[model samples]
Target chain A: MRLSVFHPVSSLIYFAAVLIATMFCFSPAIQICSVVGALLELFMLESKREFFRNLRFTVVVWLAVAVTNPLFSHKGVTPLFFINGRAFTLEALLYGVMLGGSLSAVIMWFKVFSKVFDRERLLYIFGRKTPKLALIITMTRGFVPKLKAQYRRICDGRKCSGTYMSESRIERLKASCGIFTALCSSTLESAVQTGMSMKARGFGTGKRSFAHSFKFRFGDGVFLFVCILLFSAAMIYSGTGKLRADFYPRIAVSSEPLPMLCFAVLCAIPFILEVKESLKWKFCLAKI
Target chain B: MSKKTFSNLIFLLLIPLLCVAGLLFFRDKLYAWLSVGITVLCCAGYFLHFEGKEIKSAQLAIISAMTALSVFGRMCFAFLPGFKPCTALVIITGMYFGRESGFMTGAMTALISNFYFGQGAWTPFQMLVWGLTGYAAGMLAERLKKSRPTLLIFGAVSGPAFSLIMDLWSCIWADNGFVPPRCRKFFVRLYRNDAGILVSFKEFLCKITENWQVRRAQSR
Candidate 1:
């Protein structure tokens, strides 16, 4: 199994630590480390084509954030140029790029996060904490595809009946609205039926027991421990003015090397694990 | 009035004050706290309002179904730029079922859909905006039920409202402080596209009402 598919708790802790570090740490070095780590992890877990598709999204977000920041924010002393009467500062521009990079890094991490923690994992974690909420999430997940199918069926039916042949904007709007109203009513009606069936099955009567396929092993425990230790160490360094950056008056970042190294190690944890796992798998396959 | 109604009234009254406080005092440092605070307050009010009455499984299912429908509706119309029925569905839900249900549906829809769209700092703001639209629709449910034109107007207004609230987050994040001129520019650019969706949605609602009336007349 992949390293990220470890026990749910381990997976959550690792992702949460990396995401928090990525979001809170303002140092450009740490941000770049996170972006690289996330990209490497994605490449390891997903296909090359998938990685490129995801990269497109991150690049767009990064560019937008980078370009817009300097226009709205005129902070810092080093003026690059005057843009439409507003002073565009070098610090602000650099800060914008850093912000965009961090934002993209966060987005990439979440992409990995969503892949690891699918609906089943989320339900496993949240079921005991809040059963009703978990049930609602499950129901919502189930309903999305069903609703899409229903919409297609409705559209096809309308087309067959010559009702969907509308060239005017108003006629198209009416047809779309008609389709939705039908969908809304039918879904609600079916929901009531489903609710009745669930009630009859003794739902919401008492404490519910969920069957989970995840097993916590000694390796998972050790993995959690190492993640927690590294995450806390990185956070402590961040708190002690080691990861500080000032972008307002001028661009300044801490010259400390130890904290940056610690952050780099923390961000690289996932990529390292994935590489190790794949190497082990390859060695075993060669022996076989 | 019952204690719950009185408390809800007070909560409604405090929303404006909260907005003003976030704008005037807590723009830089406490902005996240303020956004989280508003979300928590709205959710707390929802739960409190529904306390003691076992919100039946049917009710939960309906909320889930409606939220799913809205999210799917958004996905289906992805080819159409900015034309989504998310707000219209929320309005209809609020009109039929009470305010709390409306709020729950809107907030949950935003949460679940963000799983696909990629969650960010802006998710909470989107939830708050959609939730408030549903809540306001519920508040004026009586009037909206009586008049289709009023419902259309409300739907139109809500489209812009959702866009404006979303832009507020971008404004705060981009500027790091509230700058009126920049905000106005951003709002205009963003709302211009969103306004098309709202107008289309309004027209859709009007068409639906007219068809319903005609069908009723024929049946009678």
Candidate 2:
């Protein structure tokens, strides 16, 4: 849904609120709303194939948790069935389903999180706060493709030397190990040099500054403020304990519809933003 | 161990104990939050540990290279169901460098590899286990370097140790408590998947560690 149109910080704050609420708020309605919102945003952002791929994994997780939890935790009343003389209670089953829903919702949000917060955005968001860690992560990202290339080169060299050839699986395995060892020593030596060279270049001395240079535009500020307002309203309402649902002994729902509506609106912010953006685009097209 | 690094290690150690205590106290409802808390704390702790230290760029580069190598090793072995050399390589890094470096290498390997493999709730648990493996190797570095057998034994022991922690995590995740039978089942399934690589894993790590040990001695 063009989440990247918002600033990284805005996106970060939005996801953080949703995640905290989903994990902490025990209301089934809130959790369901959060999952549906995340799924809707995911559908907008990803192709059908990719969306289904993610859905498949998350659904499996939900079903597995929902089905297995009741089997192990036999703590509720209203037994639905009995296995080996232990009553499989409805409360436990519902509780498990509730747990699964929240857990999967969290996962879905993170999936959306990963997709939206690509490398540059992450670097922009976290780079300044922890420069050394950011630098390491950046360097590692830069190094993987290079290292993979080097590994391929090494394998090719072995193949050319006739050392890599073998129908015998053990022989190829041994050659691969040799190749790995060779790559290790070379990389380690170069890395030591890289470290020493960095020492000469005056790194990690003090005030290591970084940012991908993201502009906090007027639109970003508006988005962020809206997120905070909605988040606080949802949280304060949920915090009053009116939005909590208790499943032990029997399912007793204690929630105000207004708080759930607050949460649902907060969750749907992405969709609203996308619709607004699309409408603007269509307006501009008509003008053209 | 400098005070900062030592304190950092203590923090790392305290988190899991606190997690267990939390699970016991809360008793079944807060596990998803608990996992989220763990993931955040581990990343924050790792960041704070390295943020302002007099760590050289070379040291940073070295850690990046080690992490890249470990991740590359993992990707290379992806075809084989469970024969991952990532743990053994991480242990080697720990044995060669200090503990913090080891922990960084191990943790970063999990984080970066998951970019390709797809991250989820399990990422933090994997990072914790692998990082601890490296940290333990660093702590026992003297013994690990002194003899071939000890190095081999540590390598041999680390696979099961990694699986043990992950299996424990799954038990907590699914059943919401320590269901022993479920844990045992996970352990066996994991151990069986891992059995094929243990011999070569240990042997390869011992050889690499021996090479570095000699070089380190010569340099000193």
Which candidate wins on DockQ?
Answer: 2
Per-residue CA lDDT of model 2 for A1-288, tens digit only, reads: 356767888889989888877766668888899999999888877899999998998899899878877776777879889999988899888887987898889888887888888889878866866777777788888888987899889889877877755867667667777777778888888788888888888765656665456788888888788778877877676556677677777788877788788889989988777778889999999999
- Tens-place lDDT per residue, model 1, A1-288, is 465569988989888778756765667877888999889888988988989989998999898888777887787898889988889888878888998998899889888888778888999886764566677779999999898889889989999987764688667666776788788768877998998988898877977887888899988998888888877776676666677687888878883787777777877877898888889999999999
Give the per-residue lDDT digits (tens) of candidate 1, residues B1-220: 4547746764786666766644543333245535555665665555445443467888888888989988887776665677888888788778777787788788878888988888866777787788878888889999998987799889988888788778777666554558686697877787669766876677556654555556558879
Q: After TM-score superposition, what is the CA distance of residue A91 in candidate 2 from its true location, in Å?
A: 4.1
Per-residue alpha-carbon lDDT of candidate 2 for residues B63-105, written as tens digits (9 for 90 to 100): 9999988888788767566667788888887887888888888
**What is the DockQ (computed on Cα atoms) for candidate 2?**
0.44
Task: Quote the lDDT for B151 in model 1.
Answer: 91
In model 2, which regions exceed 4 Å deviation? Answer: A75-92, A158-179, A196-211, B1-28, B31-39, B173-181, B190-197, B210-220
Model 1 ranges off by over 4 Å: A163-174, B1-30, B33-53, B204-220
Task: Give the Å error, residue B88, model 1.
Answer: 1.7
lDDT of 2: 0.78
TM-score of each candidate structure, all chains considered together: 0.85, 0.83
